[model samples]
Each structure stands twice: as structure tokens, then as C-alpha cells.
Target: MSDSPENDSIDYGNLMHDALRLLIRNVLTDVSENGLPGDHHFFITFDTNHPDARLADWLNDRYPGEMTVVVQHWFENLDVGDDGFSITLNFGDQPEPLFIPWDSLVTFVDPSVEFGLRFEHHSDDDDDHDPDPENDEIPEAPMEENAEDDTPHEAEVVSLDAFRK
Candidate 1:
């Protein structure tokens, strides 16, 4: 057999994926400590059905495939770590906290700086889509309690279509 780079050796896509993921973790860490500065905000889209994703019961019914969240004005208990991040936001006059692992996240966008990233978290097949089930190895619990306070707040739903043009 001839020695070649494509001789069933390295997975370049997987390597690049991991490197790009690190960028997200770094950005999150900064936000967790210093908080978002100026007009900077994030439009994060993630797989709602991901094993590590913990959202309110109602959200699953609404967004079965994926859900995008705007991290701008109204959010609480923002925590970012090695594995993932968790934050609480108000929806329909109630607190909805969600835990989303890095592996679960499909997109991360910052409109202010025109920075965006899209990760392939799912397979092409309509069926047999196997997401990385990190939960099987590590047990997890909801990060924040359901706050009864009906704080009226809203998160902007940014459309990427505008940027495309």
C-alpha cells in the first residue's frame, strides 16, 4: 500500500470543527465574566432535542428541530464552562432556563461585528440522526430554578437573510 494523506488516517473536518468550537468557548467565557459590551450581542441557534439541552416543556413543542436565542438585554444566571453554558430568559412572562452543550450548538452569531459561525451538529439523513449523547456519560441537572416572576421581556429574532444580501 502506498503512503498517502487520504489513506484512512486523519479526519480534517473533525479537527477543524473542534478548533472552531474552541473559539465559541472563548467568546462565551469572556461574556460570562465581563458581560457583553456595547452593541455586541449573540444570536445563538442550537438543536433543541440535544440530550444536554434543557428548556421549558413548552419550547420543545414549538421548536422541534432547532431554536435560536438572542443574548442581548434580558438574561440571567449566565454561566459558561468547559462543557457548555446555561442561561435564563423570560418567555411568555415566565422564566425559561436552558442548558446547551457546545456539541449541541449549531450556530453562533454576533451581528454587531458581523461575525458568524455555523457548525454541523446533525447528520444529513432525515432519520438515523445520532447526536453526541454526552449525557450518557455525565448526569446533568437544570442550571436555574423556574422563576415565578412574570418579568415582561423579549429577545430579538435576527434574520440572517438580511446579512446574506
Candidate 2:
């Protein structure tokens, strides 16, 4: 047998990434069929510049690189598919449609349950470059309960690094 670089062997990283993205898809699919259960809400962050991502021109211009969206309180027409999902969200009472591909997701969080996932984008050319720390940060979910409650709950984010060997 010929020797090969570990990275060239079984790619657990990509496997895990795909699995997590599927999890998000499944969750969204459920929510699309039946509205968010209890106080469960999501804070989804995605790369606005991703080629597959579709958003309003003004939104792209305002957010530039990345934007975080709240999937609670006032979203409409949530449609989940095998590869991505689309939904209409309100921005200052202006409803705009957004199509976010699963691959463009940077982070997904449900602070009510204190659960989250962070995805790291890897590319052949990115092998030598360090990951952007900013992308690692999961945005805090919007208040899903009484505004008087100021307690903060930390999310248990599942990072692939923990499973890497």
C-alpha cells in the first residue's frame, strides 16, 4: 500500500459538515410544516457573497460579507428543500425573499434550547490560510420571551474540531 497524507484519506470533516447541514435542513423542514415549537427560534448566519445565496440587492449591499437572520417572530413562506431553503423576512416592514443555500451557512443557533452548530468553510486554496475568527462566533438569538428577563443563556455549540482526530 502506498503512503498518503492523512487529509487525503477518509474525509471525516466533510462528512460531518454534510451531516450537520442535513440536520439543519431537517429542522427547517419540520418548522415549515409545523411552526417552531415552544420558544424555539433560530439565528442563522450565512455568507451573503456565496454564489448560490440569493438576497435583495440592498440587503447584500448593506450586509456586504455576512448577515445573521432571525427565524422567529415574523418570518413567512418558509420553504425547505434538499439543497437549501427560502423564506420571506421583514426588514422595516418591507418583506423580502431570501434564498440561502445550505453551503452558505456559517452558523446555526437555537438559544432557547442552548444548542448551536458552527460550520467552517474549507477550500483547496484555503489549506494554507487560517480560518477567520469572526466566522466562528455564533450570533445571539433574539429575545423569545419576556423582554423583562435579561438572563443570558449560553448555547452548546457542536464544533467539528472536537470530533477531529
Candidate whose lDDT is highest: 2
* Model 2's TM-score against the true structure: 0.74
Q: What lDDT is reached at residue 133 by model 2?
A: 46
**Candidate 2: tens digits of C-alpha lDDT, residues 1-165:** 447676457766667777888889999999999999998888887777778899999988777777889888999999998769999999999999999988777778777776777664444555654455434444343312212211222222443332222
What TM-score quantifies how close candidate 1 is to the native fold? 0.69
Stretches of model 2 off by over 4 angstroms after superposition: 1-8, 122-136, 139-165
Least well predicted 10-residue stretch by lDDT in candidate 1: 135-144
RMSD of 2: 10.2
Q: What is candidate 1's local distance difference test score?
A: 0.65
Q: What is each predicted model's overall lDDT from 0 to 1?
A: 0.65, 0.72
Model 1: per-residue lDDT, tens digit, 4-34? Answer: 8677677566777677778888887888889
The C-alpha RMSD of each candidate to the native structure, in angstroms, is: 12.1, 10.2
